[model samples]
Target: MAFVKTSGYRGLHVFAPITPTREFLDVRHAVIGAARELARRMPTRVTTNWWKEERGERIFIDYNQANRDRTMAGAYSPRPLSHAPVSCPLEWSELAQTDPHAFTILTVPNRLRDQGDPWATMHEQPGSIDVLYSWWESDLADGLGELPFPPDFPKMPGEPPRVLPSRARRPD
Candidate 1:
């Protein structure tokens, strides 16, 4: 759960130390693969940058907080509530057992911290494998509609437009 640094575009800083099972591959590869899969499911963009590291690998995913808000009409229906419910990570040990190949079924806005650092962490596998099986009992896909847009967001069409405030007037 180490905070890397704030991204140039968004306020979200790059976080690392997400303990995972045996990581024979590089961190960027794993993260990019996961994010690519996420892009296939959602209507969002993702980016990554490489930085120097001493030991274990580090992966970074940058997303716009503003895009979180959009029309959720096609999401959940029949249900009275506007959004669906989601579940949190069961435990750190549980996530360790999760099959790395399994496409994560995120019921909630997943935080990287909960996933643990795959670069340095280790756990038993095969028989007694622990995994954070996201509760898919409910329509969590529908619940994604509940998330609100980021704060101080500009109401406009197309990639959220940005505008700088006017400069202060100088005294005479």
Candidate 2:
């Protein structure tokens, strides 16, 4: 697991890679649980601009990034958005002092030349998601179930009805 602060915001972003599995929703649940747990341990905040409005502080796990079809920008790849910013990786300790704007396409190469890749040994050891899955089970025992999926995905097994909460009809 890795923690990063989003550029231009005081929000936390977590990146967790799990072994290949067909149980996508289960993975999503576990990841969310883990994010919540991490949030509880840290002094940071999480926010989501889901509906064009900032939903105030909460642990917002980006489970959609875990979807099979989705992909994130590579560590050194330049974003197509403004200023040609690059998605640079950083050491966990550097989080407090690092500025996102300083690591752009033109500056990353020199940075890399001066200091080798922070993620150089990232794949030397593998991690298991078993503990997270266990957390998933514990959350289930406490009555928590699946969270919402992207609107474009087909209705999945055990998924809650896809209606927006405001339009959802409550049980009679």
* Predicted structure 1: clash tally: 15
Cα displacement (Å) at residue 72, model 2: 1.0
Clashing pairs in 2: none
Candidate 2 regions exceeding 4 Å error are 1-13, 16-26, 39-54, 163-172
Q: Taking the tens digit of each residue's C-alpha lDDT, what string does model 1 give over 17-113?
A: 3445534222333333444345445533432222223112333343232133422211111223233322222233445453322222232234345
lDDT of each: 0.30, 0.64
Best by lDDT: 2
Q: Which stretches of candidate 1 lie over 4 Å from their true place?
A: 1-5, 8-11, 20-25, 44-172
Q: What TM-score do all the candidates reach, one by one?
A: 0.22, 0.77
Least well predicted 10-residue stretch by lDDT in candidate 2: 46-55
What lDDT would candidate 2 get against the real structure?
0.64
Error of 2 at 4 (Å): 5.2
Given candidate 2, what's the lDDT at residue 24? Answer: 67
1-172 in candidate 2: lDDT tens per residue? 5544333223334554445653766667667566555655763675322322334555565766666677666677776766777777777888888777777789989988998887776665556677777877887788866655678888776667766566779889
lDDT of 1 at 117: 33
